[model samples]
Target: MSLECVHMPISPKNLLVVSHRYRSFQKDPIDLVSPYFDNVYVLVRFNKFADVSKYVHIPALQPFISSSKIDYTNKPLNLEVYKTSMFNLPLDSQYKKLGKLHLSVVEKIIGENNLNFDLIHSHFIWSAGYVGAKLKEKYNVPFIVTAHGYDVYDLPFKDDEWRSKIEYVLNSADAIITVSNSNRECIKKLDVKTPVTVIPNGYRQDLFYPSDTFKCRKSLDLPIDKKIILSVGNLEELKGHKYLIEAMDYLLRIRKDTICFIIGEGKLESRLNKQIKLAGLEKNVKLVGGKPHNEIPLWMNACDVFVLPSLKESFGVVQVEAMACGKPVVATRNGGSEEIIVSKDYGLICDPARPKELAENISLSLDKSWDSKKIDSYVSQFSLSVICNRILDIYDSVLSN
Candidate 1:
């Protein structure tokens, strides 16, 4: 549905969004949702003591350091973002205490600015959702939390203590919004009484859309003759980049014409590089570090097929972005990819972490003739306007009652 068809209330409402970062998947929805609200107050939480660059001396790890700095020059007009930091030592044991500490920081910001909102919409469970839950108690506002990826599927199930903490944050919210049915099922495992809704994450249509393959390849200086496979995501363990590298090894043995480009930076870069070297895929698989978010579309358009070899995902929005660019996807049956590539017509889905199966599917995707327009048309339902409208409907329903 178009944004024009979305119902708007007579009186304007203000929204407060508490999130981990103001970029990519988190920021896209807020940008789309901003036009519907009078004011969108975004509170971004950062750890002051988490700067690894200051302590670590390794050169390879230098690029993966977490930065609290955010460029606000391009933010939306109605969106007023407040970034706050807390001094929390980087330790796994210290995680549960972060919620209260984060809440304290948010309370200070809200008090100093005298910020008020009709409702609280927070992303993630710990820290942001916890802060939103506490703020709801103080202000008596409807609180909503979106549980994305690791926060839902991985964190809570680690132990009993964490499970209780995650459950408390979820139960406190007026409503819970998870990205996929896979995530919704994870929430159901917790047995929380709060109403849960499945709202898949969306891609920016303006940034990622159908483009000429030859032009995109020429612009990016990529080889026009080679069959290019692209994967854009952090080079982390959960992302399953190593498996993709393995799959590339298998593909190279059959066809020397294919080359895979892995984008994004992380702690696993050195390890993945070693694996690539050992497998003798040095010429085929290129670990082209993180590219700017805007430049991703160019890479997407230049590739023959997009591959997502994630071990687990609440929602793989990158797959949607690739489909938006009119490219066929070869993804593993990670929780989210199966939902997006429901039919083989859209793309191919293989078992996660299996090099042989991933290799077979990647080969099939490369050989198959896919309709670019059909792929683009199929992904339009995941546009920002459609996602934001559904979210707005949830906001209206929560506030009206």
Candidate 2:
């Protein structure tokens, strides 16, 4: 395929993005990248609530762009393709199947829409990267990939075939990016030739800043006097909630007044509840399901400490939010957390699967004193504007090449 370069007077080379599960416009990189581009379009596979177009805020932004949805509910394709199944199957199985589906979908989009995208920016390497590579083969357009953790860590274990698919995307994408340097190293271990960049997940700090702790606690019906510990992630085994519950067992042994809140729903919710009961921590720990993203900073401010004990992570965004709210954090050494947490300065790092260590770290984060201003200052490195500008530079370098 002969790739044609298109120069735009007002915007970036027309870009097409593919994200199977774009939470909302607030949670999208495409939205951040849109300002740096001429026209941007995102194609999402399946939106269960028919909410992708409604909740995602791309339509509001001008500059000649559109958001389109594709129906895959009844399609012969596997539903789990391009979706996270919470560390159940080997990571590679999900990636391989997802790669195949991605190729098929991209072909359909190009043919049906008569599209002319100068560059393809895929959100994840599993489905989007694979599809982007295939599109590059057909359209000859350069494509860039974003690796959001699990796609690199969980997939290659015990499955060589699936690992190859990841390698293909990593090596082929014009520029590769992950949420952290830890993840960049993981990709390097795969011997990928493409340039890989470490871009920590960025957020709109203006919207996600800290609020008055007293008012937030009162609004949430949480006790004002007791110290609160917050954790936000899908309730799954890899999230290591079991370890968090076990940590609570230790916290209560010393400070009986502490309360731990685990937010976000998942299949392991029932099992996590059972573990909580077994630990005799009914009063100390509570499992609260997922809440809107906008309401998270309030939860952060209301808590004294934020704990993220994931067995694996690309980058833990919740930890950033906590730090941004001037709250201390206790996270695991795995993946991105090791790079994000500023050691004993901002948060403590312990083994996520080890209950005793997790407990000790959580207690330390809550009881100890770290300069809140320092923690907040460290978090400013990951501000949306900083990361977005870096991303734009990467895009510019790719286009110039």
What does the lDDT read for residue 157 in candidate 2? 48
- What would you estimate as the lDDT of candidate 1? 0.87
Instruction: Indicate the TM-score of model 1.
Output: 0.94
> Weakest 10 consecutive residues, lDDT, candidate 2?
59-68
* Tens digits of per-residue lDDT for model 1, 116-153: 89999999998799999999999999999999988999
Clashing pairs in 1: none
lDDT of 2 by residue, 347-376 (tens): 888876888888877777777877888888
Off by over 4 Å in 1: 1-5, 54-73
Tell me, by lDDT, which candidate is best: 1
Cα RMSD of predicted structure 1? 2.3
TM-score of each: 0.94, 0.83
